[model samples]
Target chain A: MGVLKAAWWIARKDLAVEIRSRELIYTAMFFAVACLLIFAFAFVEGRTTIRNAPAGILWITIVFSGTLALGRTFERERQAETLRALLMTPVERPAIYLGKLLSLLILLGSIQVVVVPLVGLLFGAPILRAPFMLMGLLALGTTGFATVGTLFAAMLTRTSSRDVLLPVVLYPMSLPALVGGMQGTLWIFAAEPNYELVQTWLAMLVFFDAVFLTLALWTFAPVMGE
Target chain B: MKLGDRLIVVLLAVSGLMLTASPYVIDTAPYEATMGLVQRIFYYHFPMAMTMMLSAIVCGAASAWFLFRRSERADHIAVAAAEMAVVFGVLTLITGPLWARKSWGVWWVWDARITSTFIMWLVFGSYLLLRRFGGAGSEVLAAAVGFFGMVLVPFIYYSVNLWKTLHPSNSVVPSLPTSMGIPLYYCWAAFTLLFVALMSVRIRLERSRGWLERAYRAVED
Candidate 1:
């Protein structure tokens, strides 16, 4: 199969499984809600929410639940010994990596669909301000995060202590993306939104996603042991 | 003695001599008008920072070599360089706060260089942790980690720099007076020599451990 076609099929396979079970989607969304509630308690004072808290809370909730999802997604592959078989296929390894990244982006995207509005509703963040810019930041930021996360989580699949190692490895490597996301969202949530600064941050996010995705693709083959 | 051992011995001796005389050398340099004696720590602090940066580069390059070429020697070098990064990173982190305490009246600042350096330190430290607990076939995994960390260096630097900058800029060395510059260069050489010597020892130790493991397997057969 062609690389893009194979990637689509792999992504479809994962989505089909997820659609049938709804386990990861349900759990990860609940975990994100729990994180939002916990942070609301800490940041919401009397009637007013802490200034700039929503930006940090939104990005952090994504990161935490994203890590959980990355771990379980790979854990499932490892459990059935399907990853080895997947690797044995004649399809290119980059295709496998792309497929995994796509699925993760979708999974995280769905969770955000709910979490973003909740943040705006509960904390009065101006989520509707510059909707396109917000979506661009979210999409690119999630891509950057999931690109690195997928590579590391896939590599960590065979390790004995994966659950702990995934976050330890993923967080530092993906911090630039997280910072860009938070800062962009912060600008959006500001009383007077700075579109110029938001543009700058969005540009940085694009750079990060491009560089990280390229590296992840280039290294996936060797790291997975061809 | 083996060539590696002799090299290590010579490097250690020379660097030791340089380090021993560094205090006097730094003392001879003129003090600053604003910061006075606290600026002296810059000699050590700056060199440690350079050495740590060098170590990170070396680790990343070595990791790339190991991942693509599967060179065992490269793997050994990567491990040694990572350890050096962590050791020197800790030194830089500690001395930074001390200097900042005197210079900026604060322990830590989210300055571009400081934040990126801290993140790099965490990544390298994570590299070590992954190797320790990752079990079998972790060398390749750690190599991937190192390579990714290396590529992220410039991105992180640029992003953080654009965000905030409270620390002194990077042009201090070029603008330094000759008297101060001489001592600063001297300390840099000493720290670099020491870094090379320590890396040699660590690489040798790692190779020996590999040999011992292979020999044990031979006996089992």
Candidate 2:
């Protein structure tokens, strides 16, 4: 099979398994929701604070729960010995990385589907005001997250303490995405949203996603090699 | 000890004495129009920040070399540099806030420079953590983290300009009067030498540890 075809097949396999098992998505959604509620409880001094400060809270929730999802996804491959099997195939390393990234993006997107709207409902955030912008930010930020997260997860899979190591490795690297995402979302939810600021932050997110995705793809082979 | 090691010891002692005398030297410098005596912390704080950043670059470069060449020497340097980064990073973290408390009227603020520095510190801290706890292939993983962290520095440096942060910009450096500037440069020199001395010592320690480990393994086998 061609590289693109191989990547598509791998993504399809992961998504199909997720559909059958439904474990990752359900747990991720629940974890994200729980995080959102906890943030609301801790920070909601009044309605105004909740409405105004949901940006940071929202991004934090995504990061914390996204770490869990990435860990679990890789854990499946490790536990089933499927990662080794996949490697034994003729697929290019970058193709495998691309495929894994696609699955993670889908999983995170699904979690955001529930989490974003629930954040709006709970925090009274006017997130829907610029729904397209919010979606753009989410896509860009989550792409960076998954790109780096998948590479690190695969690198750490053989280690015994991967669960702890994944976040330690991923969080610091994901700062630009987190900062851009939070800042853009903050501007979007402002009383009079600053289109200029939102645009600038979105541009940053785009840059971060491009750079990190390329770097991850370049390094994936070396990192995944035995 | 060898002559080279003795020279390093002498260099370290002089640097330590110079660092100790820096407070008095800073006090002798004319008080700033704005910040006053509390600004003395600048002598140490700025140098620590510079050293931290320098160590990060060293670590990142060493890590990249390790990745490319798979040299155990490169790995040792990377690990040593990372350890120095953490030490200086912690000093920077503490000294920065102390200065901020006096200058900005708050102990901590999530402004751009401070935020980025904190994140950089955590990144290296995590580098050390992974090396300690990650079972195998941890060096490679840590190298990856080091490379990524280095790549993130420009972004962090420019974050202040990108956002409306209260942290002073690069403008503060050029505007320094001669009295203050001289002392600052002296501190910078002292700290840079100190950093190199410490790093060399750490690298030697790592080499010794690696040799010991191999020796033990051979004996056991």
Candidate 3:
């Protein structure tokens, strides 16, 4: 089968399983919203503080919630005999990767859509103007997160302690995407875009995607097989 | 000693001498004392940072090689690279704190550079931690660690930038004034050689250990 077809199969398989049991996304959404509420009250906040703050809030929420979903993504596969069957197929490995990452993209992207606006609404920091830029930043940021997250999700699949291990390993690693997205998101909110910071962050985000994607491709077969 | 061994020894000795000499020339004047006598530590600190960074990269590379090739040599090289990384990583942790105490008043700040390096220590340490977790095959663990290893660099880097942190981004390797920059570069060169010397020795020791383990297993079987 073609790589795209394989990816589509994996993606569809994951989606079908999730739709049958809305267990994963529900938990992720609950955790994300709850965490945002906590961050709102738990931290010091002035109107001015909230003004430059929505970017961080969104990325932080997405990461935490995305990880919650990602940690569970492959665990169930291991628990059952499903993954071994998938591996027995003749499809290339990167297709398998793209498939797994695509699943995370859907879950996290959905949660992000919900949480970002909620952050704006409750915090009274509405996203004005630049909706396109904001959405693009989210796409870039989420892609970087999923790219790294998919790799870690595979790693955590076999380990006894995948839940906490996922965040511990993933959070510190995906800082660039978070930073890049945060900055781009930050610019989206401002009256004037900080052109230099925006460009630098965008470049870093893209560079991160290229390098880690290659590294992941090179490393995934063994990590997952073993 | 063999020629290769002697050259390494001589190079290490020369580097040490240069590290010692830097303070006298640059920080000699009574006024130039911020990173002064203590700043002389820059000579070693930069090299240690370079080695740590290099070690992390090599760990990632070796992780990939070991996974794809499934060779014992790749695994050993990776473990060796990680051991070397830990040594330099420790130096980074220690010297940065010392420099911070002297430079920033507070020894540790949740700054960009500081926090990122700390996270790297955790990540690298956890790489070693993987060897202990006997859940599955060695190949899997190596692949997992390799896959995730280098991902830490960006997060550690941009963490501070994302949230406001106290660590300044001296970026470990921006251009420097010739007076101080040139000596620092020598120190870097020296440390690079020193690290390779250490890696060679460690790789040899590791190979011996691997042979011994196999021999023991063979006899038992």
Candidate 4:
């Protein structure tokens, strides 16, 4: 219960910061929108390909926007050594992780709200069919990605090239999320009942999250040693 | 006394040379016209692909170790293993495409195996690039990437088994007759040794370079 309180405090603090600045949400939305606009125009000569390729463009935008948000989010901790200070508290490592991850979900989820609509408008697809499953998969997939990515961000924070290295490694690790998320979204756009595929991919994502998240917990103490 | 590792190295060097010249020395059944002599690229290409996968696996294991023990040595080994993987990856990519060009009309295809392999390479390569700029203790960074890259490899290999696959079937694995399997295993063993030797040498070099950097810094201090 105490750990939960600490976790809640951290989450609230992060939300408060974002609310005050509003930079994280606004910038991520802009990049996502701009990506769709550019991809739409670039494939002007190939409308057939564009129709087929909107899936790729949509994913590309989410991935890039996710990276941007993740980098800046961690960069905040790095600048202030906030993660280290957080460690000094009595919270369980996983609680801190879960808390930060929940806040990340909120932030990235907001970006998705704007990004998904923008994608729906540009791509002209029926993405709202089975809305709960669609949103559930996205949430699961992004949580898995952010869980591992945030762990790496913690490790790389002490390094000099944190910015470049984080994405290079983080993006690769998140391929399952990329595959599962894209496939789920594709199903949503197809307006078909593919809840089975959604469950299977979500299972894959949960497995990945469990394994890597444990690894991060085991290393966090050593990674941020006193 | 057991023969020193260098003996193994010399034996490997000799075996590689022989495999390189096997077609001229032995008069086996003539390869089909379409494949011809170029088909020998198959021997090198398959082993290189196997070795690249092996390298990624090593990186993954080492990464797991780093995350577990937080030993700098494990981190160094993980990073070293990943660096070694690049050469094998390049060899596979180059020779596989070359074989493809000869086998099919085009230089590349959108086949599952090829795509997955290419994606794996990008993942590892990008992971390495991240390490280069990640400053000190970059191994943890690389390990995270390596571990994740490995997750995709089994899917790539068994993708055919999972789906009604269309790519070229894997012929080099078990269940082949001895004539082909023997030579193939010989070549596989030799290439794996070559990979180990390369990794050892590279790891030594990296350690020395780090030592030199630290020594210079201490002198200034």
Candidate 5:
């Protein structure tokens, strides 16, 4: 089978299963909302919210819920012993990786659909300031996070202590993405937004996505082949 | 002794002698006009940072080799380099704060260079943890982590430059007077040799452990 075709089918399979069960989306979306409420309580004093706190809070919620969702997605595969069978398929290994990444992007994208606006409502972030720009940054930033996150989480599926190990390993490596996302959003939320500076950050995010996606694709085969 | 053993001995002796003489060399360098005596910590601190960065690169390259080529020797070398990165990273982190407290008048700041170095240390520390706890077949996983950690160095570097920074710029080294620059380079060379010596010993230990494991399997069979 062609690589892209196989990848699409694998992604479709995951989405189809998700559509039937509604397991990951429902839980992850609730988890993301709960995460924001907690942050809202902590950062929002009776009437006023901390300056620039919403940007950090928004990214943190996405990452935290994303981590939970990433773990459970693979945990389901592991529990059913389906991942091994998936590996046994005739398609190339990168197909499996791309498929997994595609599904994760959709899952995290859905969570962001809910979480982004909630941050606006709760923290008064200027989400409407540059709507397209905000979405672009989130898309690039989420891609950066998920590229590395998917590679590591998938490789970690066979391990015993994945839940603990995932964050320990994932957070440090993805620091740049987190910093970029938060900073870009902060600039957008600023009283006087620096569109030029935000564009530079967006460019950097693009660079990050390119480098890590190439790396994740290159290493996925070897890491998972074993 | 085998040539590898002899080389390790020689490296250890030379590195030991250089490190012992480093204090006197640093003492002779003139004090900075601004920071005074606190600046001398730069002799060790700069070298520790250099060693840690080099060790991280080595670990990453070795990890890539291990992952692609499936070479056990590369894995051992990568593991040893990771340990060195951690050791020197701790030294860098500690001495940095001490220097910062006196020089910057604060214990820590979110300076670009300092934050990037801290993140690097965390990455290597996580590398060690993954290896220790990742169980069988973890070498491949840890190798992937090491490669990613190394790849992050430049990205963090570039992104940090976009932010405001309090850390002294990299130009501080190239523009230094010969007296201070000499001592600084001397310490760097000494620290590097020490890294090599320690890595050799650690790699040897891993090699023997592998042999012992294979022997145990053979005997059981």
Candidate 6:
């Protein structure tokens, strides 16, 4: 099969399994909600406080829960011993990475769907003002997160301390994406949002995603060696 | 030890003495019009920062070599360089806050260089953590982290620069007065010598440990 088709097939497989089990989806959503509630309690002194800091809080929630989701998703493959089986197939390695990344993006995207609305409700963010732009920024940011996260998850699959190592490795590498996402989201939330600053941050997110995805692709094959 | 190892040890000793004497040298330099005596920390602070940056690059390069060659030597060098990076990074972190406290009137400020160095320090710290706790094939994974970290240095620098920050971003060497410049260079030379000496010794230790592991495995077999 062609690489694209093979990748789509693998992504479909993961989605089908997830649809059947609903284990990763339900747990990730619960975690994301829990994170939002904790942030609300910790930082939300009043309406003004939540309104002022919604973007930072939102992104932090996503990052923390996203790390959790990545770990759990990869744990399934490792537990089933399916990763080795999949590798033994003739499917291209990069295709496997892309497939995994795509599924993670879908998983994270669903979490965002619920979390973004809750952020708007709880923090009174002006998320609706620039809805499409905000979605674009979230998509870009999540793509970057999943791209690197999936690669690292694969690399750490055989490790004993994978749960701890995943976030430790992921967070520093994903800092630029997180910062850019937070900045863009902040712009979206502001009453007098600066178009110029938003654009610049969006461009940074794009650049980071492109560079890291390429690097992850190259590094994945070697890191996941026999 | 071999003649070269002895030479490195002697050079390390001489540089150690120079570093010890550096305080007096810095004291004699004309005080900055703005910061006064507290500015003397710059001599040690600046060199430690340089050594930390150099060690990061060296570690990254060694990691790349390990990825390409899969040689035990490259892995040893990478781990050794990472350890040194952490050591120097800690020194830089502590000295930077001290200087910042006196100069900026704050214990810490999210300045571009400061933030980048802190992030870089964390990256190397994680590199060491993965190696220690990752279990089988951890070196390969740590090597991957090193390679990504090397790639990240410039990105982190640019991103932090693009963001607004309060730290001074001037070129210290080019703008330095003669009085300050002399001691700064002396410290730089001494720190560089010390880095080389430490890396060599650490690499030797790693090699011996690897040999011992192999011998033990052979006996078990």
Model 6 vs. true fold: TM:
0.95
Best by TM-score: 1
Clashing pairs in 4: none
**TM-score (C-alpha) between model 1 and the true structure:** 0.96
What are the models' TM-scores?
0.96, 0.92, 0.80, 0.84, 0.95, 0.95
Q: Each predicted complex: what DockQ? A: 0.67, 0.55, 0.34, 0.41, 0.61, 0.65
Tell me each candidate's i-RMS in Å. 1.7, 2.0, 3.5, 3.9, 1.9, 1.8
* Ranking 3 against 6 by TM-score, winner: 6
| Candidate 4 residue-wise lDDT, A1-226, digit = tens | 6767877888888899999999889998898888878877875454433543555667788788888888888788778878678777777776776677778889989988887777667676555766777787778778777877777776677788777777777765666567666666665565344576666656765665666567666655555554
Relative to the unseen true structure, what is the C-alpha lDDT of residue B169 in candidate 5, on a scale of 0 to 100?
Answer: 47
Question: Which residue pairs come into collision in candidate 1?
Answer: none
Tens-digit lDDT track of model 1 for B87-107: 999999998888887777788
Q: How much is the lDDT of residue A219 in candidate 5?
A: 94
Clash number for candidate 4? 0
Off by over 4 Å in 6: B165-180
TM-score of chain A of each: 0.98, 0.96, 0.91, 0.88, 0.98, 0.97
Off by over 4 Å in 2: A45-49, B159-161, B165-180
The weakest ten consecutive residues by lDDT in model 1 chain A span A190-199
Tell me the tens digit of each residue's lDDT in model 2 across B1-221.
99978977987898889888877777676677787777888888889999999999999999888876789999999999999899999999999888877776778876667778888999999889989999778899888888878887777556544754422244332232335477888899989989988887888889999999999999999
Model 2: pairs clashing at backbone N, Cα or C within 3 Å: none
Rank list by lDDT = 1, 5, 6, 2, 3, 4
Q: Is candidate 1 or candidate 3 better by DockQ?
A: 1
**Model 1 Cα displacement at A223 (Å)?**
0.1
Compared with the true structure, what per-residue lDDT tens digits does model 4 show for residues B1-221? 33645664675576667667554433353464767877667667788888998888888788777766776677767777787677788889999878777676568765657767777787779778867776666666566667656765664334322221321254322221234544456667668877777776666667777789989999999
lDDT of model 6, residue B35:
76
lDDT of 4 at B159: 35
